[model samples]
Target: MRIGVIGGGAIGLLLASLLKQTGYSPVLYVRTEAQKNEINEKGILYLPGEITSYVYAEHIKDLSQMDIYFICVKQHDICSVNSRLSGLSGTVIYLQNGMGHVDMLHNMTEEQTIVLGTCEHGAKKRDQRTVIHTGKGKINLALYNGNAALLTRYKEVLNDKRFPVEQVADWGIMLIDKLMINIVINPITALFQVKNGELLTNTHLHKLAKVVCSEACAVLEVNEQQQWKRITYIIEQTKENDSSMKEDIALGRQSEVEGILGYVLKKTSHQSSVIHFLYLSIKALEEKRG
Candidate 1:
């Protein structure tokens, strides 16, 4: 199967490398000239573990020829890049950070086949061509537009390779669960300028994470209309690693606090004033840092 990977950052490049490693020859399509030069010049170096070796890709080409496309750009760029990628017939995988990216991409694709993919396969770029796998969380997949054939093909690859894949019927819950994790873990870590684990050392940080998670859980319980989410479990998952947002802030990169905390605060009508406070505080923190 021909897979197309968009964005050459950690997530996109990692997924593309995994697919290619497991007998699926995939083409990687990146946006920037710098990224293109990096991928072409050095190729992708994926290290799943300390002992794992690097894998180079052969089908590096344009975006249209892909049978499955992985969209892994930052949240703000989702709409613009997806708009440019309007005419693809393949299933698109959203592997970026933050929540609401699928909705933005949905607006661009018009009910097009999309994959709501999640991975805690923690990756950080060692260099432009190399990425280091920091943690091992299973990859989850959900079908949005309802293509059974595409879903089957997706599961087949993931399952055969022993990659964790779940075809969630109601991905909004998954989105909420992820949002809960991102909301708490991301901001506190960013605000404190600490690793994900460092938040635990501060009693107030732990309380703050709980507060953010609680707010997110409340919003999810009402808005997405689901209860299967594990809010506490989500918060605890990234207690050790540095959150993507925290890392972004430390590196002077923009974050998705707007998409994660701001979305729930603005879109969902919650009566709790504490939720509003938490949301606003996080928003201000991100802006000040940005």
Candidate 2:
């Protein structure tokens, strides 16, 4: 299968490398001429052993013919490429962080098959052509619209021992399940400037996370205890790692607070003061940084 990965960042490179490892032809859509040239020359170099393999890289303006295109960019960056994506007709799997991109998907061309994916994999980009696999994780997938049989085909192509993939019938549940995790962890860690483990070790922050999770559950109508366990498990699994939200704040880049919290706020009529305050706090940080 010919698979193309958009957004040559951490997840993009990781996906490209994994696909190549599994004997699939994966092309990467790079942002810069330099990155495209580098990968086309030296291939994508991934760690911990500096494993290198070749893959094709093209400018976003230059579209390639492929069976699938993985949108591995952050939610906030999706709009920049949405128009380009509309022109392509193929299976476009979006691996965004939250439910925010769900609405944006509605605007895409109907000729394309839209697949929603929630990735738990932990990865960091060391450079333009290198991505470090921080922790092994699963890729939970669902078909929001289009051909349902595509899920079976994708499962066969994407599933591997290193990065297992699963397809669920309920797309809404799959999205909310992942959103609940993001709601609890991303805001607290970014605001306090702590690692994932700190949320569990610090009593005050731990309780605060519980409050936030409770508020989200109240609004979303989900099981609180089950969601809390998922939060803590993810924290323990990626304890030492800094969250993507915190990284965005540190780098002076925009975070996905809007997608994580804003989406829930928009969906529900119930007022969640805690989530509202945190959402405002993140926006304030963005303004201050600006």
Candidate 3:
């Protein structure tokens, strides 16, 4: 299968590398000509093991003519590539962080298969051609709309020992679970500039995280206890890693706060004080940093 991975960020690089390792010559579509040239020349440098996988690289405009595509861009950038994606006839799996991009998928043609994916692995882009894999986690996939058989087939084809893939029955549930984790971890860690582990280690932060978790569960109408358990388990699993929002704040880049907490705010009938506070805090930090 000819796989195309859009966006040459951390997740993009990691997915391209995994595809190469899984015996498929995947095309990695990057944002710039310079990055494409660099990656084509030096290949993707995967860290921890220092493995290099030489995959094909092309410009994002040339994203058509692939059997499958993994859209690894952020929520804010989804609109920029939606037009290009609409032209393709293959399966397009979106691996964005939050639920903001879900509405856009409704525009896809019935001929094309759309899949929603949530990545649990912790990855950091060191440079144009290098990515550091901080933690290993499964790629949870749920069929948003389209062929269920194709989804199941790719679930097996993409599942490797190093990079596992699991299919969920409900796309909404899968995304909500990930959103809850981001709601508690992303904002708090960015606010305090702490790692994932600190949310549990720091008693004060832990308390704040619990309160935020409760608010999120209330807004989403999910079981707070179950969500809290899942959140803490992920925190422990990726403890050494920095949340993506924190990285964005530190680098003066825009975070996915709107897709995350902002989405929660839109869903609630009444105002959630804690969620509102975090939402404003993240936006304030973005303005100050940007």
Candidate 4:
């Protein structure tokens, strides 16, 4: 199968490496020619054992042919590539972090199959050609506007022991669950400049996280207690790993705060003080870093 993995970020490199390890020569579509050339020349360096996998690397605009395309870009950057993705004949799976990109899928061609997914794996791009797999996690996928059979077929083709893939019945619930996790973990970690485990180790941060989680659950109409348990469990699993928002702040790149907390603000009629505070806090950080 001709699999096209979009973006050269941590998630894209990790997915490309997994496909290569699974015996598929996946084409990795990066934003810059420099990244494409560098990856093409050096191949993808998957860390923790120093395994390298050689795969096809092409510029994002050069994306034309592929049986399946995995959109691994950030939610905020989805607009830049949505036009090209909407016209593809093959299946396009969006593996973005938040629910912000869901609206763009409505404009895709009727004939094209669209899949939405939430990634839980902790990945960090060490360099253009190096991706460190920090923690193992499953990818939850749901059909947004696609054939049900395609989900079953791709689940078999893409599933592996190292990188597992699971199917979900409802895309809304799948994304909401991921957003809930992000809303609690991301802003606190970014603001405090700490790892995922620090939320648990530091009592003060843990209390703040619970408050943010409760506000998010209230807006999304989900159970706060149940979601807090899940959030704590995720923090435990990815204790040593850095949250994506933290990395973005450290690197001075625009984070997905708008997609996470900003989305919550838009959903509710009543004001969410905690959520509003976090939403503005991250935006302020972005400006300061810029």
In model 1, the worst 10-residue window by lDDT is 51-60
User: In candidate 1, which residue ranges exceed 4 Å CA deviation?
Assistant: 48-62, 106-111, 222-237, 269-290
Maximum-lDDT candidate: 3
Clashing pairs in 1: 196-239, 196-241, 197-239, 197-240
* lDDT per residue as tens, model 2, 1-290: 77889989889999889888778878899889999999999999988878896998998778666788889988888888787876667788889887999888778766667889888888888888999999888888888778888768888767889658998888899999999989998989999999989999999999999999999998899999999998899999999988889888877889999899999789777664889889999999988998
- If both were scored by TM-score, which would come out higher, candidate 1 or candidate 2? 2
Compared with the true structure, all predictions reach lDDT values of 0.66, 0.87, 0.91, 0.89
TM-score of 4: 0.97
Score residue 3 of candidate 3 by CA lDDT. Answer: 89
Better of 1 and 2 by lDDT: 2
Candidate 3: deviation at residue 258, Å?
A: 1.0
Give the poorly placed runs of model 2, Cα more than 4 Å off.
Answer: 269-272
* Candidate 2 whole-model C-alpha lDDT, 0 to 1: 0.87
Task: Write the residue-wise lDDT of candidate 1 on 8-92 in tens digits.
Answer: 6777777666665676666666666676666666667778543322333332234465667777778877876676667767777
Candidates 2 and 3, the one with greater lDDT: 3
Give the TM-scores of the predictions, in the order they appear.
0.84, 0.95, 0.97, 0.97
Residues 26-93, candidate 4: write the lDDT tens digits.
99999999999998898999998899999889999888868888999998878878776655688889
Which pairs of residues clash in candidate 2, taking residues 3 or more apart in a chain or in different chains?
none
Task: List runs of model 3 lying over 4 Å from the truth.
Answer: none
